[model samples]
Target chain A: MDALLIDPVLARACGSALAVILLLGAWQKLRDMAVFEAAVELYRLLPDRMVPLFARALPMLEAAAGAALLLESTRGIGLVLALVVLGISTGGVLINLLRGHTDIDCGCGGADGNTRLSWALPVRNAVLMLLAVAGAQAGLARPLVWVDFITVAGGTLALLGIYAAGNQLLANHPRLMQLRNGS
Target chain B: MNEALMISNALLWVAVLAALIGLFALARQIGVLYERVAPMGALMIDTGPKVGEPAPSFELPTLTGNARVRIGGAADKSTLLFFLSPTCPVCKKLLPILRSVNETERSWLRVVLASDGEQPEHLAFYEKADLKPFPYLLSQDLGIGFHVGKLPYAVLMDEQGRITAKGLVNSREQLESLFTAKELGVASVQDFIDHQHDHQRA
Candidate 1:
């Protein structure tokens, strides 16, 4: 039963779902830059050097992802990016949950003024992963969607740029010693 | 002792929970973890909670302050008892939001904050959050059945005062059902949702 609930299959499923959420999230974040912007502000919770880079690039990275997911050509590329995003985001949630930081909201909501923290957030991502897997399996036969390709690619780049800056900021901040382990 | 040694604050403890879950998650992938622990987990999870049976109750020690009580003792309104500690940053973050739940609903909740420290710390917490109006309790028992080993456990009771849900209450839709039932005298599940929708539209 425990195996049934928390099984390797579930973890894999979770990972896949994470992929969907992250890819989609990366795109939404690109357009709004709100949470990423807040996360950048949280850079002070990290270090000094990473802030400038994070604040400047995160929005663009998300925008790129939006492009990739929308474009049919880069669907595969976008899916890969989605998996990576979920891995990081899941790690963040687990880390916070364990460390007793439950108040923190999942950082996936887009730039719009939505303050949602529904159960759907996680489940939706999981479904997305299944779709990603389908998309991957059908990659060869799948038709093209240039808009998705452009959006996802764009979001990926935007996220990468922001993440780099964010990491650096955490590395520099002296007071945010807790972030030193880079959890 | 080892757990104590590693843990210093509520935030750190939550991080530990995540890390530990991650370990189990990773272990399941590797097969090393499951080969050893799956049997034990199955036994524990299966016999633990079920329907048509009265739910278990708990009296836990507050990990961050001075107060304690046993929740789910029969009452008029079904109680949605939750255990959280101030030292836990997660709990702290949730406090302000919970404080406001009463204005929307007619208060089917009796939030019992269980912590693991002295009165001063608890007092400090009350002052910090300005939660003087809420009921607080101390738990020396470490919130065993209330899910203190993991932090942030909640239990719900029906109007008949029977346990409807316990341990973790993350299912927003289901949890809301209990609240709706308590808020309105409506009995059925669909009725509550329909009424809620009407209320929303109205």
Candidate 2:
């Protein structure tokens, strides 16, 4: 296994470098207005039954994933974060292709300029996955602890609360309306 | 007084315990739904507001259509909404299918054919379908809020104005798969269409 075989110092170096690239990538994505718009478009395409709760939580996670990748202390944390980002991006596009709705762009990581599904996306991910595998091997994280589960459970619940409140706020306040209207 | 009251109190506690169990189950279901929706943002379509979202309240003044009707109001009934355009050809195919459903489903549901034209040609299409007396509302009031880009769009709402359904109501099976029932039937547009097809064949 790469974890057992790879040098920890080398792995850490690789992870730190990958983290910089990912953080820069995430920053670009965060800066692009259209990336956010694409996300909203995606939100619109979802079935009514599933929209409300997701519309809030996913964006926040993405924002965090980008931010955490740059920090040196969160080196191993960054790999896990990168896995989540790549896994969802690669998998979601493939699933959407299967679902028969292909008009929209994949919009992966500030990818507004890229129109077509190219070799770049999967290639980027494959490399990231390798880097993450190396770091994960070095870090040798244990299986999810009870504390981790509790944390995710608490986080998920907190996400739900935030969504509920945001929906209510968007409903009652016209400031959300202003955002909708390009203000 | 002491013994009889003690027995009554025990029964009360049992009832309370059962309610808590039911509520916990409901919370778990909500959690599961939350997990499903997260991270799949690009796939969701704009429904009148959104599905599971509280529908926006609006009533439009029409020159050709009948009186203004309130959408997303707690009218104490179920409503099937269509955010449609006169020029949309898909909507032309969808209307008859909906009318047939409206006829078969009866008074349990009301279809509101919402359109956003200040023109007469658009109103003429409504005259053609007749909508089985479905209330057609104009959308001059809230075009940006509704995100009226496409046609043949539809939504289902509860008595409380939260969307039960949205997007192109494609098939009876798809709707049935999406629908969940509790307490009373808010009715389903999917079942209504499928049964109507079944009835016509029968």
Candidate 3:
């Protein structure tokens, strides 16, 4: 299972997908700083004063990590940062879940901000982290030529679209349940 | 031979990429269908009184002095038991909508507001919201009895005081759904959908 997970194509696809998601998340946080701040506040993880500071700093860090992931030289550092960031945030969600604070907004950036903290979120983060780890196992077996770039681009785009659709489905599940049950 | 192998590899990659994109597009279509099917409304938690059963009976004092209101019995009028909290923002937002519903359905429906909290705080909230139209009662026991884990919940009882529908209502649509469910003689939206499916099959 472990060897199958770290295939070169899968690694490249996961890396690009993670990078795209992080960049988009960073851009969204930059667009609406206050909303992101409020979302961070909802977590109740950081002290009240530090909430503002963390909210302001998180987007920049994500952007840096995203940029590094795209560059061959900085890929390792980027993967590490991605791991740390994803790990901490997943931990935050886990803490809230254990504490029974599932009603709080996840503050995951962009259209997903309204999503409440739940088990699915931490699991999503865990999957993303796994992708990042696979991506970290760099040094491809074959030397990449011009043709490889096309393959990577196509693979990345495909993965990103699928990831977005999956997230949407996750967000829609609760509403579906409510509708089914007859609110 | 080497050149041919390289060309085939490139073609294979392109084909795989195209296939993946097609899969993604199909997933998007499924998402659109999911959105059309699923809607936002109150959630019916599988706890407390089940539908078609007698609502737990209770006598609680009205917010006003020296008056007691009866809940869950063979009352001639159907009852809309709205559970709210003074501190709940959603509950506050739903108050006006509840009032309008009460006004429109006054002849056949009796809307009651139930909460579990300090009397003075509730009185303050009632005054602030100008809640003179509905009977407001304070009872923690009632909330516990109903197994209300969330705020802004509503329960509909038929004229015979049996629970027709109840769920954790968050929006006006959700609140209305309870009535719609009861009117259709279904326990929930899912039940209604299933019944329709069965009818179609028949």
Candidate 4:
């Protein structure tokens, strides 16, 4: 563990990127609570009665976790919360995929709400989980420097760009398949 | 040596950032291309009267007044038969679009609203939606004649009373695609796409 410890700059960069992604997702859900609620209902993992409660609470939890991750003091709790949220979502998607119900909306906020469930979603969640874990790991005891700031900012922005690009690819996958099938 | 290493690291990080930005822009362009190339007109269900066939005629009474509405016949202008229901949320969402189409295309088109339900409910919806400009009618025979199995279906008829285009339309773009299909002399947008593909291959 000691040998594997990352620099504080790297950990901070990961945490910042995850924080931005979580905050943006939470904002999209909150923008249209009704649409999110409908998406949750379509998942059918939760009972009809619990759908509204879960829908309302999930975004609040996401926003809270994102805020906590921004501060070093609360990052541990934020990491745990993010893992739980991602676990629940990935599990829901996996269950539906196993049942061969791939036509349902992903409910994950994207360029549009029409993204369908597919294998890529679970893989995306796994990548995000890995980021959360890396971000949560304790850093080596080293003094901060001016150059570290530039590296951290650059790293975080790069991570966010990769994430956005991945999401666009995922969103386009179904459309690409449809086009290919000539439907 | 430490100063030299730090400078190199900073330069490499900047380079990586630039590359990531380029990748992101490339991905966004791919998304735009998909949107442009995807055939996104109103979905045409093949159960209804075929395009270019004479539309089944109907002379139903308007919901609000005693005026009789003639659906299919030789008219001075083209007719747009929009099938809707008061209970359909999408249909309600499209009322404003239909009104705008009525206003803009009034010169060459006549928009008529059709539905089959209780008169009182439709009358209430008709009043609430402020659809006084278009002629609203209720006729089960018209719906049965068209074999409409979906809400928010539409049929476009030319002045010769021939079915120019028909489909299940959900958005303003889909609604306009009916006119586009007619103008292009294609049976449907899917047909148009296939035609384009054939031309490219040839």
Kindly list the interface RMSD, in angstroms, of each predicted candidate in the order they appear: 17.1, 14.7, 5.9, 5.0
- The lDDT per prediction is 0.46, 0.52, 0.76, 0.81
Across A1-183, the per-residue lDDT of candidate 1 in tens digits comes to: 544433333333333333444455556655444335544332123354664465445434544544555455675676676555545454554555555544333445532221223333345456455544543432222344543343334343433333333323322222122233322
Scored by TM-score, the top model is: 4
How big is the positional error of residue A133 in model 3, measured in Å on the Cα after superposition? 2.0
Runs in model 1 with CA error above 4 Å?
A1-183, B1-43, B46-68, B83-97, B114-133, B136-143, B146-153, B158-161, B171-174, B180-202
- Of candidate 3 chain B, the 10-residue stretch with the lowest lDDT total is B37-46
TM-score of 3: 0.53
Span of ten consecutive residues with least summed lDDT in model 1 chain B: B37-46
**Residue-wise C-alpha lDDT for candidate 4, range A57-176, written one tens digit per residue:** 998888888888888889899999999888989999999999987766677886555577899999989988888877886688889989889878988998998888788788778767
Q: Candidate 4 has which clashing residue pairs, if any?
A: none
lDDT of 2 by residue, A24-82 (tens): 55555545443334343452356644544443445455556546654556655666777
Q: State how far residue A134 of model 1 sits from its true place (Å).
A: 27
Question: What's the TM-score of every candidate structure?
Answer: 0.39, 0.35, 0.53, 0.61
TM-score of candidate 2 versus the correct structure, residues matched by position: 0.35
Ranking by DockQ: 4, 3, 2, 1
Expressed as tens digits, the lDDT of each residue in A27-139 for candidate 3 is 98877676677567667688878977998788888888888887778999999888877877888889989998776557785234435667888878888887777776774
Question: What docking grade does candidate 4 earn?
Answer: incorrect
Give Cα distance to truth, residue B159, candidate 3, Å: 37
DockQ of each: 0.03, 0.03, 0.16, 0.19
Query: Over the stretch B1-108, how does candidate 3's per-residue lDDT look in tens digits?
Result: 988988898787678767766765665575545444432233334367899999999988898766888899899899999998754545766887999888877767
